[model samples]
Target: MKKLFYFLFVLGIVSCSTSSDDTLENQQNPTDLEPNKAFVYYMESPKVSSLQPSWYYTFNYKNGRLVKMIGKFVKSENIWSPDNFYSDSFTTLSYHNNKIELKFSNDTYPTIVYTMENDKPKKAELYNQFNELVTVKTYTYESGKIKIYSKTYTLETYYTYYLDSNNNLIKSEKLEKSGGLDKALTTTTYSNFDNSKNPFKKLYLLNDNFYEKSLSNNNYRKINYTIQNLQNPEYLPEIGNAEWTYQYDLNGQIVLHHPL
Candidate 1:
């Protein structure tokens, strides 16, 4: 069964779409460019919502690997299960001007290789299978986004960025490593703009822990969510609000998805 759909497409639980170039295509216009050639967007989520709409299993990393994947469908009584179908691609070294190598497989199984060093990468290292050095990563990259620290595996990871002055990648924020010892998994953040009617505003704090999600279009149709809880001292509570109603055809895609 192709290794059971490649372990349900790398355990995405189902939902995928592929067409890579590291996304940002819809005719792009992030302010007209220059900030070091910005065009980065990546996200993956297992699940963790302070309220609702917290599902993302994404992929697409250009000169690096992880090519593309963006698919979705969850019906149930309507019956749909191939493990759910979420699996993005490009997980084997593609390009790393500074230095990059990554290989991880599922369907055929037994494959894992990760190596990254683009100027200090938190002084990284993770090699096993007799290659030696087990694990280590203490990375950092600003402006373009990337933060990783592995206090001997306690794990701490991040990728955050949102641009519009023509830098592209309207938005993306992802914090990783969840489940069991970490208890449950997934934190997500992704945003986009320019199909204007409004075209701006994107926020996500998620498993960095305070819990937050926001995506705005001013009006155009509605995709709004605002949640907060910074450990509340006097922030008081009544918290509740959600909206998702969109439809865009004529090639722009996004057919329909409602919740209001």
Candidate 2:
């Protein structure tokens, strides 16, 4: 199933929408582009102790939305081991207006919710740990892009995106339906673009009911590369081909993306 829709579209859990504005712009500037911390390095070998950093991340925001997130692993070079940290695997968030909910202090993890209406998104739900309801994604939009549909009672997936009049996204596709037919496995495309860095523009600039306003600046451009074409293709020829690099800070955000 195209790696299960690329692991539920890289974990955003699936949902999309746009439209909103009320002179938007709510207090940002917690050091201008709040990212707080991150680190992840690799490349081992026995040459001069070769780089390290196995994992790290820390972020928290309130007015600008992120809410909370924490992770840690690196326990060697540049150390980081508050006793092997993992405080229940942190992650928390909750918002209302346009809906949002991501809870996971490890209750066997599973809780994600999102909903929006005329202003896009539309639905995404997945609850567990006694709250039941395991999956249901929906979302639709045409000419302006977006098309997800993930149900679950065995399986049913589909995703599609293709945007570029500055809406960024570029391309993506994946399907899977089986007995009722809807094959096609994967296709992805994206190009170079840095037009002023965009690392997910802080997921639509932190709650104004999860604002959108045509994606404000059209979903933060900066995608330098991505190309995945697979329909079996030997099961995954090393991601088919990949390359991406990024690093920014003087307010351009990002901070580093690597992937080469």
Candidate 3:
């Protein structure tokens, strides 16, 4: 079923990463998200119009590389203050010769090691706190955008990204492997983008939750399409078609966002 409406909030995805030769990574690696000093110091997840409990995170960069992320606080009803960080909210990044290692404050998570090409991931390896390998992730890129991501832990999840000529995301698909067949679970599409800069562009590996409109030329209209029954191989229900818009500041920055 396809569902659409005047979006109350847009979900921006900070996707995760893969492996390869790395002798020249330091020299060949593209610059990080912060360029031209257009730093997105602070970001609020679930940038919904209504007031509610939301996660707030602050970003830090060194030499243009995203080095750390700290979840400062959460909104509780009407009061906005810091009681404590939400669970597993602190993350640290390490840039190395071959890959970038991401460690979370929560001990339960494995360190995610990602290799890169042109600022996108090529391979990833996860290790437990005990330094034992937990799993390995891989990716496929076309035209500098990650086309396919394969993650295998207890179960396997595959994601495919489709981009337009402007290198903006057009759609994304979630696929699952079952019975030696790839089963598509969901598909999301983005459109009607304003010709402005996407502050979140090139900000890879910031968060695990990635959406189809996560990175684009500008904030765009998002329409999600779900298969009523992919196995049935027939028609799906119609989605509510609604138009959406966003307000941007004069500086071309999205006004919905705020500084840290």
Over 4 Å off in model 2, which ranges? Answer: 1-92, 95-100, 103-125, 128-131, 136-151, 158-173, 179-186, 199-201, 204-260
Model 2 lDDT vs. the true structure?
Answer: 0.52
**Candidate 3 at residue 17, lDDT?**
16
- Model 1: CA > 4 A from native: 1-141, 144-162, 166-243, 246-260
- Tell me each candidate's TM-score: 0.20, 0.26, 0.65
- Compared with the true structure, what per-residue lDDT tens digits does model 3 show for residues 12-117? 2211112232333343335323432221222332323332234445567665566776653334554464334463467788877557888877656548888866
Clashes of each: 21, 4, 7
Cα error, residue 175 of model 2, in Å, equals: 2.7
Instruction: Rank candidates, lDDT, best first.
Output: 3, 2, 1
Q: Give the top-scoring candidate (lDDT).
A: 3
183 Cα displacement, candidate 1 (Å): 17
Write down the lDDT of every candidate, Cα atoms only.
0.34, 0.52, 0.56
Select the stronger candidate by TM-score from 1 and 2. 2
RMSD of 2: 23.2
